[model samples]
Target: MKKNWMALLMGIVMATLLLSACSNEGSSNEADADGGSGEAATEQVLKIGNDQEPAGLDPHKVPAHSSIRIYEKIYDSLLTFDEDMKVQPELAEKWEQPDETTYVFTLREGVKFHNGREMTAEDVKYSFERIMDEETASIAKSYFDKVESIEVVSPTEIKFTLSEPYAPFLSYVASTNAAIVAKEVVEENGDLNQAAVGTGPFKLDEWLPDNHVKLSKNEDYYKDGQPKLDGITYLTMKDESARLAAIRTGEVHVTTLSSQSIPLAEKSDGVEIKSYQSTEYSYVGFNVNKEPFNDVKVRQAISLAVDRKEVADVVWKGDAVLSGPIPESMGQWAIDVSQEELYQQNIEKAKELLAEAGYEDGFETVISTASTYTDMVDTAQLLQQQLEAIGIKAEIKQLEWGQYIDTWTNGDHDMLVGRNSSGSDPDRSIGFFFSTDGSANVWGFSDEKIDQLAEEGRTTIDPEKRVEIYNEAQKRVIEQTPNLFLVSPEKFFIVRDSVDNYSPTANEPENFNDVVIME
Candidate 1:
């Protein structure tokens, strides 16, 4: 299984040393930001460690969380999720659902984009219409498929017309995918890939590709006396140990920690580990458009070979629970894969299924994973061992965050290990990934019945009917095996003790507006 006890032990020791070193080296230089160590703490900069570097700054194009982290800083949606995941106002101060198919929103006045132009209802309409446009191919398009039209009522009001009733629509609006953009800016730059102009608390200052993204405070932010920090620096530290080391060395103020690094972070000085339950689920996805996986039996056989419980225990150290196509964080909407026979691992049965699929000797395939996410790497390595038991020779392809995302996004790999956030609703959890036109459906899985049921689940407002629809949908996704559903690990973010008001939100990207770094 490529398990190295020594490497793990060394990793813990190294992680500790790395984080400790950062605190020592950064303390002196960190003082320079405020003029001197003895001077008053001014121009407070919150240095954050990003395990996966953002591929781009565009919200409509890149759905990667790394990119979303920056998007949440640079852009504002009509609505947002509070720390409790309850919907709250953002760009749109208030809204109303006059009917099942209509929504009217009144935009807050004088809210200016990073470029100083006031955000009008036209900008909001343009932002959503751009995503709905077929050419843009936004991954979040499926979530808004019911959006029939958008109309600007006035300079401060926008109206939306839906073709059908979609219960999960509001939650989708709260997603960064629906982030507002400056129409003139997008037209000028071709895209927000290199340039970002949004109405947010922080404005983009400097973005050094593969290095860091620096953001400065928007003095004209709509919120009064908020965004406490003078600036936020997103440091791309792709390695888990390296990130922890950055924390230890005090090179960065905060970073997300993997289960493997939790113990190391917990014991480290000058750090406070804040954790919460999250909607994230990790899975091994098969590109159903490709062979070997093109056949459902092959996909099912491979899925049946791996033990999910073992994966949870070994990888997440029991901090996670077994997940299905829908994650446990979805509550009653999620099916208990532990009770499902399809999720139970059986090498002999898996071999039989492979034989029936005319690959009795098994097949050679690649499992692409991101090098930035160590848990995904560890999961791939363990799956490599488990698959070998059924005679399948699987090669592990570990690429950097950018390449790995590209490989999966373009369906260039047979299979891949990736983790995703499911959000608060089941429709967002399921439709965003497995539905025929699901924005995250890079697995190339498209099914008529699954698509129909997903539509039904969202359109049918009856809670009982929704439960039945999603239940059936979940079972079908499991049987079809587009993805070998794994576990939903808890959220863990390690922060320096100097940082305050650092609570992590369950539904949105990490927002640094309220965070303060004591100099």
Candidate 2:
């Protein structure tokens, strides 16, 4: 009897052990079915080191480049540009031009804002009206000068009436400046300079001024299974060295690398460099309203003095292409005019022109630039040397980006070393700078012929005719010498190997909505 009882006890113990083992196996399988581990199940975050802190959260108020880097992820424009630089639908599912001066847009359905409010045509109207409002003082207002009125036909349909037949209106709508904002949110948050609420792939989570801005994935994003990453954090690393260091230490997943730092990044472990042909060109812009620079001969002389190839080879490490007033990225709109005579380094000709311009002794002037832009600073220094060689005393005045912008916009500087958008369209690229009332015409360059040509180009509906008009305008601009056209530097991004689908556009900001992280 004792043996039988012991056998039974042993059987029970064995049965219990077997059941426990089965339960443990099932739990493991369940966990695996859901996601490998707790860590894997958790949200994936991507950290990026932005070269500079965004000036403001309001897309309408800040500089397009830096602000768009942030706004592109937070807001949705009526239209968006594709890889081919073609206008594609974004918030507007479809659009049509009923007439030369009328555009009708149909909004996407089932789109919800971050505040759980449905987007309507009225919101679009309100957003655009806000930009056009004199009280708003939106920097983007100039871009929409042709917009006469916006009519909300229905909840999903809207129409835009133009004062003239503006050919670049569609492209303008696709630009960062035309990003649609939630009317309710804008109303609630008067300025929207500090906070943002939109129907983008991500929602503003937190903003630690001068440090970082955190964004979380919008679960209710219009596109299904989008914004693969759970969140993104943009760490403001103004110093290029600090940004590179952050990338090396894994503090940041991606950051833009200067041409000089490309070698360093290439040698760094677990770093990958991706290069893109950018639609941005660096140029030495002259305040045409100022002395010496006002003379076309002086401008042309300075343009001839600097060797663009040397600048490209030395300052840009031969990673840039010599560009004209319009970059080659403008497709058919870019006319390859023979600037050989003007771009050639002719010191004697430059001196003769200077002498003719009443600067026989060579005058001294300050070249204002932003210190944060290392490439621009280097280019400015190189330009200073070149100008000195021509007997012109060029003083480099590097200031903080904010101050630099202030001084440049106020037309307080004699010369400005900076980069400007060589947009996909002629109006956006050339007209913005050369047009009589151009918003970016801080140089005070005004020509009736150029203005008339720009107007024709903007109003012409035929692509070929528009191109012809712009080509003429470009020729005139080159002759006027408002800017000493330089090299268009290729943008280099240092990304981690683990990051997937991290393609950035030359014209648009980096989009991380489709990015995913691999273990």
Candidate 3:
């Protein structure tokens, strides 16, 4: 952990100063199709900072949020979600759903990747098939589990044949993982960990792990002089305070802040606050296969004991919304389990349940969290206190982000606070955590009924029926106690006042390319 922290500090220092090598130099006079007449000042350089550092440079091997952000900046997908969170054209100019189980994407014409290689249907098929190969170790493989095969119909057209009627297929491909890559580069490098090539608005110039990544605007970008900034330097810093300080000091142009840091930005000059509802939902997941936790009464008791509102207010500074497993932002698909039916900090009910479950004397348990998110640490500590009050001997362990996540996914702990970034669709969020074989299901929870409902929701063609199926699944899940659904926190961003057009989006990592400095 210390080594990574030091590396992150070094990365930030280097990112702010070092200018990496560029292969091509082009005129900046190209018109901005989005709006501007290519008349912006030529001195634009956006310095973005974040609290987390990429575990590695490989998008295929590393699924961490930090690395994906870098990948998104440099890669293009067959289709991408627009600002409205609807599927829009990217590498694929248009697509058609010929049947319930098959969809065809038409590749854009004359699209050249950073390597000057023209994007063809074969490259698109290769990128999709690679992510599904278990050897690639992509976190996105689970989402594409139903995909049967990818066949190139023509140089400009590719067909995706799925084993089942998957409603979210197109949106799934629109994910950051499905970002199109050059088949030539991946074959030559034979190692995704060291390779980087894409057709996005920027080209990766240099990646110094943990310190910084430098990306110059791709001159041959398909969108034509898109990414208005001359170049973007992503500085990885672990300290939230340091990151906020950098933004205010003008050491960096933008940085993300935690809920607690919102007040600091609100009070400070030369800083702008941007907030949006995050698809993320916080929960306390119990290892349902374990001895005490296996008893649904015991799990419900723990859920009832903790005060979620108190934790959200005191720890998060009331910057978040109280949410169950299904966040309200999910809208129509959101299932209202009701605050009364769910846990509500009732000590008497918790004690009653504990006694009913033959654990009146309480039991010993361990709670785990990562230090990268200080709020998680605080939440764990509070849970420890609350559980102890119920006569349960609770211990808290703080692990580094990498170790923490690995341990959680490997099912090595009793319980942990977890979150999932719900994508554009509710099915995307619901199906991932509750399904029996879900890769992110850390609690080892399995229920045939809930699994069936989730599957039904996924394949159900009718919107109303899908929502009903998902609602039933959510109810069953909330009742099972694998999750003590807590709160939905807002995605907070603090940037320099000079930064304009920083519209916050539903996506956790919103594009900062739209931003420009007043100077």
Candidate 4:
């Protein structure tokens, strides 16, 4: 019986070893089939959570931040800013300033649009003329007001003739609105509203409004071995809470976090926080065309009573720097107003000014804000309380971005809380807002000297002379209280550990061509 038991045990061990050997052989064969890897192939996808859907993808038409984010993805300008915000050649290989009013650009060879059409100087000329056309009504129309003509010197060379020396000309050429589009593609589609075809690293695969936008990599991109990921998907989470949840749960790879939500986001194990000093300044704008606000004393009184530091602390967790007419982020152009006594918060003085303006008892007014912008909402709420100290009763009117923009642009509000972009050039930041003929002079706040200075600054080519011109413009505008220049906050954006090669830009979306995934 013992011998029979040993034999039986040996037989069982042999059977077990044979089964294990067969299984190992099958695994090895499977690995060989999968290109020497046991794991199945994986597709790297970058998912971004956006707070709002883009109103439109036509870069020349929509200037909203939501739309601009997507524009940075699917468009490339002749010139683009580097990581350090210096001008770098993009579509144009090299450019020369032949004269103060004449600039020339040389197009790169073999660059093609998403539609597989070769890019040429004519496309650049068409794009510029289309933007300058009055029928288009582009926000950039004013930016190129001085461009007298565009000439396609050759298939690869383009020349621009300016009516006068526009100092910020080159900088504006690198701005977001200068994105070049394929002329034939635009004509075929009627407009670029639904179709986004460009000579960019990514091609717009799909854009489902209010849902998500998906893009696929451009295999034929001019820059080789870039756009490391297979594709990118922008998911619209209108609710800030939803955006936060998506990032924390790894449902989305990246998203922006509000200042108040930073502490909560820091606790997420899978998330990484990134921050930068933003070029945006939040303010309570008064329609200088409207009554009470039309009175400079009333504007000054409100500006004095509202403590900027208190607003910064409450709205941004003190993650802000006091700013002047041009935000300090622009460097050299932004005037430091911290030491100035006018910006000092003095409630008694504000009350005195109000009384002098014949409003000892402050009147009722509404503070307009977009519901989606948490920071703006919070800033408005804080201002509502801050204005109370000086007897100004403010009712917060929350609107959707669309309605808010409509009302804000049309100057249909008693007051509005919003943020403005401190553009790459001081002209964009100041000239368009304070000049009398400015299209974006939404506040109806115009001064003769401000207008003259803006024109002079545009015409002047010397940097030092332009600085003096803009400094005087900023000081004069701030004194008139067109809009109360508030604090420039440090903006925080969140990403996952899987995401690499990303540093958040100050005023625009981060280009993801060099971004890669760990797995």
Candidate 5:
């Protein structure tokens, strides 16, 4: 009986040994599957899917939002806007306005650019001067046109003297276009279209055109413990379905979605949708220099013929709000022009105005728009149909983005259906379209009275006074009918559940400095 017990114990030992060997083999296979590491895989990289590639890295060269989004990661501005769109210090620690026309900014100490050079007042002065340089032909020059001079008070202090008391000066300084760049880097690189070096939370590591733009965290960032993610990769996926698929399959962590994709995103699991009232304004502009359109009555007739509410509902899928030239996102500066009779759709009045303008049989016009934006194409088609009801023959001319911009810049189009960004401040919203010398005034719609009012709106310091000035300007603009303002479409962002603290502002790009990735 003792011998039998020993045999049974040996058998048991053999079985235990076999089990241990199989467990070891399984663990080895698991490690091999996990890139030869026994520990579970952890991703430190945050991948974002963008619909289009940025035009360039040079902040002054491109006003495209795609470029601005990338710039927000690679550069630092003097000031920045908070979640509430309030001005806040960024590179500048604090600032003081000594007088109506004089402003001083106290630079943050120990700030280092991506190139390891210490930032000083000289860099700030150079950046502003570069923007104002006529040779650069910067699209952002208008924002700083009010500055009379930039003086360096000290290595860490800078003062700006404006030609007038520009109330929106602080907001302009806070813009992404006003990002402070290293003078030495700019000189070495010449254009800074491909390379960028700035004192921000991240540094541009690599940019593969039409592929991805990669950025790595700045370890020596002045803001301590910032940019929690090790790096970020902006993947360019122009096709909307491709972007949605990338997010759904865990290939990308976040992406912006169009209104049509909102329903699909809502039904998808492990995805969260966040939306904000966009400051982008869509409009149908008439080139006042063109024949027939030169007549204010013709412009007014077209504005009265189309229904903004219908456009907002059908095109935007009920995700937009009707707005005037100044979107409601401008807060108190937005004049209540909804009650204005010109804005109402009066078919009879439109026909009467057309008849009065010697177009009793209607007129032939071409509407030019960029085909890159599907919404704009739809808007043009809708406008064409609406105009047809009043015996107007509208031809839709769709062009590529580059051609569209060129046509508009050269004033070669009769009419245009496009969108413009209305920034956080009222000055940025109104000045670019209405000011006589505004770079975006492609329709040649210029009024001396409107220009004076816009000047006063920016120079006036008191809130009430500024509002009064802007209200008068808006009313005049409506009467002139340079553009038929449409709606402010809601902006949507889709993020993975694992991404935390990824909030996007209405006027600014997404700041990922505090973004965290959950395991």
Candidate 6:
């Protein structure tokens, strides 16, 4: 019995050794497929890096595109822009303008939120109401100022009633601000900021703030076989040099580059640099409600005082176009005005205006800007020196990006330097800022005639009529002089050669669904 027991033990040991050998062989094969060291195969994952991380998962709370890009993958708006930069169908497959001031949207059928709940018109209504509701304190509330009410027609249909025939209303619906949410889930959880549930192609699987956010493809997405990659991992790198270094070392795959660092990207092998027409326009906004700027003469004086040509060449590397209030990227909508006439460095004229405003000696003022980009800080410094040359004591104050945006949004700054991207359409650029309640109008500028023309531009489908209205509005903005329209900065994106399907997207929210990597 002892000999039989010993033989059984030996047989078991030999069998165990064979099984271990087979397991090692299988793991090695998987590692070979993964292109990693000999280890177990893992699901395919793509890594991306962005300048900032998500502030919140709630669509109403996320103001910046950096956060919206992540939220966009997890949420679906009533409408979405197509590759041609026109509003097409998303959750809302089709729609109709029942009247000049009303829009009705027909939601797509057979769609499910990440939480397995079927979307309904009530959810859509709730989403809009939530943003407009004062209790929510949504940063994008200003964009929806024209929205009177959102009505649910049925389970898959909804109507948006506006105060006027706003031309950019539909486009506003397509913006990151009006993105849909799981109404029931948000109501139950009371906070969607930590995690989001939507009908987008990808689901938010994990989010580690300041470190990484992971999104897994939603197999039950309305569109089938979408989100080509198994999953996406977005990492945030605030430091430009560190971000560039990370991409060089294969730590991250894609990133947005500062205007100055673009050339370095072009010189690097296995990297592609793409330039796009950004709707973003830099300007010096005067506090029209107070100070020496309250005088139209002082405002015009400042507009003519700054050397736009020099600033464009020095700060933007001569890759920008000097313009009036209206950015030239608007194409046909852009007024056919001469940039040479609209903007020129005329210190003599500026001094004259200052004298008319009763400040021939010039006045001391503070210019507020974010310290994130070296270019922004440098531009502020340059502006200070230029203003000082004409006896203007300009004080430059650099604040953190968050605080700077808050101060500007609240209209607390005497003078602020910034830009706004026009997006795919001219209406987004022209109407939003010039309109009375435009959230972006921190300068607190308003005009009934200008508002009327802007409204006409929105409702009149006739191309010629629209151009006439926009042209007149542009002229009015120049006369009011709340802002000194400076230059439009060129946008740049850099990706490693290994990253495929990389291209310039004029619109800020790029479609990353088609991006792929080589094996």
lDDT tens readout by residue for model 3, 279-299 = 778878888888898898998
Candidate 6 residue lDDT tens string, 352-418: 8888889988889999887766667767887888887567898898877667767876888888877
Per-residue lDDT of 358-465 in model 2, one digit per residue for the tens? 888898999988899898899999999999867899889998877886886788889999998776678866677878777677788989998899889888989888
Candidate 4, 85-170: lDDT as tens digits: 78889999999998889999999999999989899998999899988888877778888989998999999999999998898888
Q: Kindly list the per-residue Cα lDDT of model 5 for residues 1-519, writing each as its tens digit.
A: 999999999999999999999987886675444334342236657899987777788987677677888887888889988878889999999999988999999999999999898999999999999988989877778888889999999999999999988888898899788889888777888987888998888889999988999999999899877877789999988778898898888799999877888899888888899888878889988888888999999999998999888898878898998788888887888977679888799999999999999999998989999876768888999999999988899999998766776786778988988888888777776787778877567788889988888888887889998888888888888898888888888888899877766777775547787776654
- Weakest 10 consecutive residues of candidate 3 by summed lDDT: 21-30
Over the full model, what C-alpha lDDT does candidate 6 score relative to the true structure? 0.75
Q: Give Cα distance to truth, residue 298, candidate 2, Å.
A: 1.7
lDDT of 6 at 236: 76
Clashing residue pairs found in predicted model 4: none
Locate the minimum summed-lDDT window of 10 residues in model 6. 34-43
| TM-score for each model | 0.90, 0.91, 0.88, 0.90, 0.89, 0.85
Q: What is the C-alpha lDDT of each candidate?
A: 0.85, 0.84, 0.77, 0.85, 0.85, 0.75
- On the 0 to 100 scale, the lDDT of residue 294 in model 5 is 92
Candidate 1: global Cα-lDDT? 0.85
Task: Name the TM-score of candidate 1.
Answer: 0.90
- Where model 2 places Cα greater than 4 Å from the true spot, the runs are 1-43
After TM-score superposition, the amount by which residue 239's alpha carbon in candidate 1 deviates from its true location, in angstroms, is 2.8
User: Quick one: best TM-score, which candidate?
Assistant: 2
RMSD of each: 12.5, 4.2, 11.0, 5.9, 6.2, 5.9
> What's model 3's TM-score?
0.88
Per-residue lDDT of model 1, residues 117-146, tens digit only? 998998888889899888987867887889
Model 4 / residue 281 / CA error / Å:
1.2
Q: Which is better, 2 or 3, measured by lDDT? A: 2
Error of 5 at 155 (Å): 1.1
User: Candidate order by TM-score, highest to lowest?
Assistant: 2, 1, 4, 5, 3, 6
lDDT of 4: 0.85
Relative to the unseen true structure, what is the C-alpha lDDT of residue 167 in candidate 4, on a scale of 0 to 100?
Answer: 89
